[model samples]
Target: MAARSVLVAGGGIAGTAAALGLHKAGYDVTVVEAHPDTAEDIGAFLTLASNGMRALAELDATDAVTAVGFPLTVLRLLDDRGTEMAHGPLGAADDPALRYRCLLRGELNAALQAEAVRRGILLRHGARLTSVTDAPDGVTAHFADGTTLTAALLVGADGLNSTVRRTAVAPRTQPRYAGQHVYYGYTDGHTHAATDGPPTPPDTRAITMVRGSGAAFGYAVSPAGRTYWFARVAGDPLPVGGPGHRTARALLPLLRKDPTPAAGIVEACAGPVMVTNATEMPLGTPWHTGRVLLIGDAAHAASPATGQGASMALEDAVVLAKALRDSPDPHTAFARYEHHRRPRVEHNITVSGALSRGTRTTPADRGDDDTLTAQLAWDTPLPAAPGEHA
Candidate 1:
C-alpha cells in the first residue's frame, strides 16, 4: 500500500516532531514553515522535563538534545533577599538519566530539525500557509508562495498564532493575553565577576527561582559556564514600541532594584534581551474537526509558569502520530489524540494560571511550596504509540 501523505503546518518544535514521528510510522511527511529558516531557534532556554526527554528518546533524538544542553538537578525557590524558601526535585525520580534538561531553544530546534532531515522527512521553508480548505476526504492548503498541496491529513502544529487554527479549526477560537510578561537573556559566566558571597559548588546545577515584590527571577548555569536567566513581571500587555524595545542597559536598572542577583545577570548579558507577553488559549472543547487537526500551542497554549509548554507539545506530537499509526481511520485517530491529551494539557493550563497569579505577590506571602516543580514533573509514563513496542 502507498504510504499516506501528510502536510504539516509550521516547522517549530511541534511541527518538526510530528513530521519525524509520522515518518517513523510509515507515512510520507512534509513540513511547511513560514520562516525563511526553520532551524534557527528564536526563543530563550526551556526545560525539558523527564517526560519530554522520553518523548525525544522515542524519536531517537535525546542524545542530540543532551549534547548541547545541561542537566538540571533541583529547582530552588528563594525570596527577594535570595533567602532559601523551598526546593524540589526535577525530572522523574526513577531515572537519573532522564532528569530535566536545559538548552538554548534554538539548539533544541536545530537538533530536532537535523534529526528529521536525516530521517528523510521533507521540510520546506518560506512556505507560509495563507488559507486551508477542507474537502470530503482530504484538506487542501494554500500557501503564500502560490503553491497548493492536498494530503491525506493536515496537521496544524503551527504556534499560538497559528494560521491553520484560524482557517481549519474553529475560526472563532483565539488566544487570550494571560496578563503577565517575561524578560529573558543569556550571559557568559566566564566573562562576569562572581558575587562576593560564598561561591556555589562547581557541580551545582540547580535552577534558582527568586520571588521579588512584584516580579520573579529564575536562573541556572548551563554547560560551559553559561548562565540562562529569565525574569517574570506582572504588567498589562505591552503597547506598541514599549519598554520591551529598551536597551539591555536601560532595563537592567529596573531589574536590579530587586534583592536577587538579577542585576548581576543583566550586567553579564551578552545577547539581546527578549520581552514576551505570556498568553494562553481559552480551553476549547475538541482540538480537531474532520480531516484537519491542531496540536501544540495551536490547539492549547499555556503559560510558561508550569514549564510544560514544550513538553506538552512534544507529547501531543507523539500521541497524534501514534493515533494515526494505530487507528483504523483518520477521524478515529483525531478523536483518540484529542481524548488522550485534553485532560493533561487542561490540567497544566489551570496550574500555570495559578502559578502566574502567585508571581504577582511576594514569595513570603506565597509561602514555602514545591507547587511549580510538582506541576513540572510528569510521573506517569506516556502511553506507547502503536509503532513503539513496550
Candidate 2:
C-alpha cells in the first residue's frame, strides 16, 4: 500500500518537528508555512529543557539542534537583594545530548526545518493556510495564494493563533492573557558594568533567575559575551495597537527597585526592548475533528513562566508520531495521543498560568520523570487509550 499523505500547517518548531516524526513513520508529509523564510523572530530566545532534547533524540535530530545553541548546565536563583538564594545543576546536566539548551527561536526553527528538508520531506515556504476542508474521505487545505492540497490527514502545528483551530477545530476557543507582560532584550556584556560593581564578566554556562520585587527576571550569557535577558511583569495586557518597540528606560524603573543585575542589563541594551503579552490557550479546548488534529500551541499553549513551551511542543511531536505508527487507524492514533498528552500539558498550563498570575508561591512538583521517559522513547510501544485493548 502507498504511504498515507499528510499535510502539516505552520513551519515553526512544532510543525517541523512533527514533519520529521511523521516522515520517519513512513508517511508522505508536506509542510506549509506562511513565513517566506526560516529566519523569523530571531530576537526571541528560549530554553529547551532536557525532556525536549530527549524528544529530539528520538527523532534522530539532536545534532542538528545542539549545533546552534549553547548548553546551560547550572541554574542559579537570586533574591531581590542581589544575594544568591539557591544554585544547582540544570536538567540532566551530565548528559551532553540531553542537557538544557538556550537558543534563539528563529535559529531553532531553522535547524529543525533544515533537518526535515535533509531527510527529503517536502517543505513549502510562503504557503499560508487560509482554511481547512475536512471531508469523509480526506482533508483539504486551502492556501491564501489560491492553491489547495488534499491528504489523508491534516496536522495543525501552528503556534498560538492557529488558523486551523479557529476555523475548523473550535471556533469559540481563544487564547487568553496569562496575567503578565513579557519583555526581552540583548546586551553586550563586554561594554556594560554591573550596577554595584565594576565591569564583571557573566557566567557563560549558568542561567540566573531573579525574584525581584518588581518582576521575575532571568538572564543567560552566551559564550561570545552577549547577555540575553527577559523580565515578566504582572500587568494588564498591552493595549491593542500600542507601540511595538519600547525603550529599555521604561522598564529600568521597575528593575532598579531591586538590587539585582536586571536593571544594568536593560540599561546597556542598545536596541529596542521587545515586549509581548504572555498568553495561553483555554484548558479542555478540543484538539481534533474528523480528519484534522491540532498539536503544540494550537492544542495547549502555556505561559512562559515555566519556560517549557518549545520543549512541550517537541514532546508533542514524538508522542503523536508514535501513536500513529503503532495504532490501527488515524482516529485511534488521535485519541491515544490526546489521552497520553492532555494530562501532562494541562498540568504545565495550570502551573505556568499560576506562576504568571502570582497565585502560586512555590513550584509544583512535575509528575514522574520515568513515565515521561518511557512515553517518549521511540522503541517503546505507546500505551492503549482508555477502553482499548493493550
Q: How many pairs in model 1 have backbone atoms within 3 A of each other, for residues 3 or more apart or on separate chains, i.e. clashes?
A: 1
Candidate 2 stretches with Cα past 4 Å from truth are 1-3, 190-194, 197-199, 365-368
Candidate 2's displacement at residue 173, Å, is 0.3
Report the C-alpha lDDT of model 1 over 1-390, residue by residue, as the tens digit: 123989999888998988887887789888988888744545578888777776776666777777878888787887766577888776563565567888878888888888888888988889989999988778899998788988878999889888888887778877877767877777786332234345554334688877765567778886677778787767687775563433366556556666566677788777687787788988763477777899998988987877788887887777776777776378778766776778778877767766776632321111112432222223422343344332
- Itemize residue pairs with steric clashes in candidate 2: none
- The model with the greatest lDDT is 2
Quote model 2's TM-score: 0.97
After TM-score superposition, the amount by which residue 160's alpha carbon in candidate 1 deviates from its true location, in angstroms, is: 0.8
Model 1 stretches astray by more than 4 angstroms: 1-3, 39-43, 93-96, 190-204, 240-246, 249-254, 359-390
> Tens digits of per-residue lDDT for model 2 on 1-390?
133889999899999999999998889999999999987778888999999999999999999999997999999998888888999998899999999999899999999999999999999999989999998888999998899989999999988999999888998999999999898888885433446756656778899999999999999999998888999999899988652567777688899997778888888899987788899999999999988999999999999999988999999999999999998388889999999999999999999999999999556656329999999999999999998663
Q: Which is the leading candidate under TM-score?
A: 2
